[model samples]
Target: MTRSVYVTGVARGDGRQVVELGVMELLTRQVDRVGVYRPLVHDTPDRMVELLRSRYRLVQDPATVYGMGYEEAAALQAEQGQEALTARLVEGYLRVARDYETVLILGSDFAGTNLPAELGVNARLANECGASVVAVIGGRDQSAESVVAEVRNAHHAYTNLGCDVIAMVANRVGQGVAAEAAGALRATLDVPVYVLPEEPTLSAPTVSQIVDTLGARVLLGDEAGLARDALDFVIGGAMLPTFLPALTPGCVVVTPGDRADLIVGAMAAHSAGAPPIAGVLLTLDEKPPPHVLALAARLAPGTPVLAVPTLTFPTATELFTLDGKLGAGTPRKAETALGVFETHVDTAELTGRLSVARSERVTPMMFEHALIERARADRRRIVLPEGTEERILRAAEVLLRRGVCDLTLLGEPDAIRKKAGDLGISLDHESVQMIDPQTSPLRERFAERYARLRAHRGVSYELAYDVVADVSYFGTLMVEQGLADGMVSGAVHSTAATIRPAFEIIKTRPGAAIVSSVFFMCLADKVLVYGDCAVNPDPDAEQLADIAVQAAGTAARFGVEPRVAMLSYSTGTSGTGADVDKVRAATGLVRERRPDLMVEGPIQYDAAVSPSVAATKLPDSEVAGRATVLVFPDLNTGNNTYKAVQRSAGAVAVGPVLQGLRKPVNDLSRGALVQDIVNTVAITAIQAQGGDGDRPDAGGDGQERTEGGAA
Candidate 1:
């Protein structure tokens, strides 16, 4: 967690690059490739050369890192050989310390001298590169606090280190004089004290840790679960060598053919997030011996095991490039291994394996209505109204032929096919059966109902059929009669013109009052639900409340967690009378009726957000600041407000995800886009899942669990 710390002075290397290497080796303990640099490197002592070569991977001898090798790859290549060898030595680093886990820079000891140039330069690098300096004081025989005085002196050399010196590590102190120096140093220094013991491997992360960090799920070896940033693993076991051809680039898995033991063991371990096993080859059909099977159950449960009947060495070359991908239907072994990992020895790796999984899917879609896999196996019937002649017939063929849905066009077959050919729609005459507007079986029933509804105007039976046939409410009648699951129209009609027949034919959602509309605003970052923006120009208090509840509930069906926010110009008691009262009254109604809902507002934009402001207003309200569903006061505010928010905020508004239709029927805009038709089909499909005509929650549940924290 503590990034690169700048270590001043070196006891073992070039006094410059060696310290950088030493620190990098140490800091890779938890952070990846932390940057290293020397703020100032004046001393080029001979002992520094060998130190750099052996430990810092120096490729040259007598090479000055601060001068000729300053920008050189090896930094000290001349002192160690192979011209290009320098490239691999200090393979990756920046002159500036950068954001290292801890930047450890080496500085020449000033020894109370007044030049201060070396000390000053190091301090400048630390400051410019934004690093915290840790003075690594090294001496041959000094055990006195004066030896420690160099640390404090050099630390004060920098005036701008935001975070102060963490601690001091006394390197190479004789055991006999340790007590005296330790006691004196702690009493004098304000920072924490650290004693660097005789451990050669100070702090570099182990290969095991790197492997583990990469989430290497090892299906082999006892130390398989060990944490490693990177480590070498034999790609293929010497069995069934030909299987190596299938290996991708990732960690290697070793197994024996016919040894169900190796197969089961590898699969189980692979299922868990151990380092990847490149490829598994079977020795033959004999696998999963008693021991391996038990381990497999414990480790790679449900992981798909490939059986290669052969030996290990043959496939080694092929497996060296194996890479693993985790996906749907793949046993989410890591997430499932959390509880088991808690008992493992690799605490660091186990903790990651034990933690909740990182979401690999998109956040819940805002409108759950129903979705037919637009490109896959899922498809449903989408009706195109009559008179929409060109677009309607075209839309239906697009839905049917492209598998967006099963198509049901509302016009007479002859007319539909003729128009389809004209518009390039491939709808076969057989595909679009004729529902003679005049002679269809339901015509008499529709005529009876239509004439009765419009009878006050003295409409006759024939006139009723003419009226019903004119707009293709005749197709909606099919939906009412259970001949079709749903209908979508409005291509040649206004929103209300398309929706009116649906209302008369299908009726209201069970127990619902006013059927309203909402649009799902999906952004690359977040999703929002805005209600009644498409319908109900000015709903009273009760209607507004219903819209809020319905929008939130509809969001729940789409896998969104509903945090209802009743929006108005004023936030929570800030404004008075009609408009504010409408929202407030709506909020009250939602709370009293749907107490399970987290509803807030009569809240202003700032307070609805700005947690600081929200804390001042409705500090105790759960949904006050985090409300995901907003119910606006009236249509003008809701529609224009959502549009403004969408346009200004770069949101993609989907829907008028029309809610409260019987079954999953919906109305489209006359000017609907191609994508709009696709989205509407998906929504209608979502609406068809449950037997209930109402749009149940996406998962078919009626309510959202507040604790799920979706949306």
Candidate 2:
């Protein structure tokens, strides 16, 4: 039977999308094939379905996602009566549900639809579809008592209609009152009730959304800047000095286009980091002169400069009504929504109540989810050296928002703050710790320690003092001196600059021959470990064996089973060369060192990965067809192969994760994205949990395991 969950709301302002998105996340985490079905939708494109399809990588066709538009359903219900409407909705839903293990059914939004009693309609469809219900009630601008009554009333309404009410969510409740509302509901209702406080940022409109709402022309600002949320609107009617102080963080400045003084002043204030204004909106369609516009661009590079034909009063009126939405374009909003939902909801209890069966396969999304959950379970402090980089700051916001790990960003504190403010990212939380490498009190101490550690190599105290002030060295010293648990860098710095400090200070772990690196090749269905891809040009047989062992341990630490395949140009003695001989020798050394390990020698890539090829080439070998840890013969082959698979096979390559280190110090590519930084930081925190040792099964045992193709 296909398990189904119906998320419907009692009113239009319920903010039920948050509940729906959270449930979709929970479903994807537990199951491999999850389907989405919207029983009724407006004529506009379905934003929630698009977001789910993109975020979860769903293969369901867009045409099949929605049963019919609101007009069509309303007409059908009017012409043929309620029975025909119910039959049509059920048939459409079953068409989607039949192919998936579980389906998420989105109920109708009570917006402008001619259909009568939308809530009752949703309940009827849910009952007919045999789906459990998650009822969402709007608590916005309502008292705690009022919110509680509404939740109770909604539960009764659904249950009276024969819908299995699994849970009730009071979304957009006022701050400090969610606890009260939740307490009152729990006393009266038998089902689990979650209260999600209203998030102002979620409702704040982005600059891009403002442009669309007013039909304004954007003369400046990059995509990232346009995506920033506008928290407040400052109508610029006063003098430059008076207008400057009114500018707040994420505020948009509205002024006449002829007032270059106000425009320049606002941009200058934003550049000086008084409080990062969202952007400046010029009204009356009067653009400044080209020279002044160029100067404004120089003052704030990515700050949006928009022009609208309407006067200041009309533009402000429209801006007042514009609200940001959770859609395909706004991913940061989705993260914020998830963070808010997860904070107030007891997801474990809710999932248990829904009785969702966990899937055995570990897809890429599932693996990524596990990484974050495990890291959050045992929170650790990680230092990012590239503190002022835009991507790093954005990723830092996500990390803090998700409660993934505590962060120690190494840079000038004021500079980092100014950059974060410009990007509308708040570093005010306790989880974020900023430091200036040049002026930190620990600098002298780190200099002394670094000098002592490198004195044998003829490094003087003065030189060491200068070197320790660099962010990379400063971060590595923090990890070495126990100030931080791990370090992830190389976003703006070179890989050599990032890891050289680690090699000098942290050094290699005990019994480790040399340090190596591995990339977690996240294929569509599984994860494979490719080692020595980013380190070591060439190695002898002993060094190759050590790399293989280190890579295997890394694979197991992150929940990948290690069936070692010593990759070469040949398979099972079918070919001979110097490369083949080295692989053969390394395989022998691995079996000798770890007699219990499953390993194959001099295996070709085809035989190592394909069951049919293994049957013909090495039928008797256990590791030939089921290898999870692939140790490349050299760095050249490993690096190229991982990139090939990443591009050609559309795989997600997650590392260059440095192994064989005493403490966790991972490096990133120069072109790493914001999510890449987040993933690397999580990996570093997990590694810091004392799993990077010779024991291959150190972190693997007793940990929650999910089966899949990758990580």
RMSD in Å for all candidates? 22.5, 4.6
lDDT value, residue 493 of candidate 1: 66
**How far does residue 538 in candidate 2 sit from its true spot (Å)?**
1.7
The most accurate candidate by lDDT is 2
lDDT of 2 by residue, 580-638 (tens): 99999999999999888899989999889999999999999999888999999987788
Q: Candidate 1: minimum summed lDDT over ten consecutive residues — where? A: 702-711
Candidate 1, 418-520: lDDT as tens digits: 4443332334434354466655677788888778755766989888878777545777766666666667776666676666666655656665666777887
Off-target runs (Cα >4 Å) in candidate 1 are 1-370, 374-380, 386-398, 401-404, 412-415, 422-424, 428-441, 452-460, 609-616, 691-711
Error of 1 at 529 (Å): 1.1
Candidate 2 accuracy as TM-score: 0.94
- In Å, residue 395's CA in model 1 sits off its true spot by 4.4
Candidate 1 local lDDT, residue 105: 41
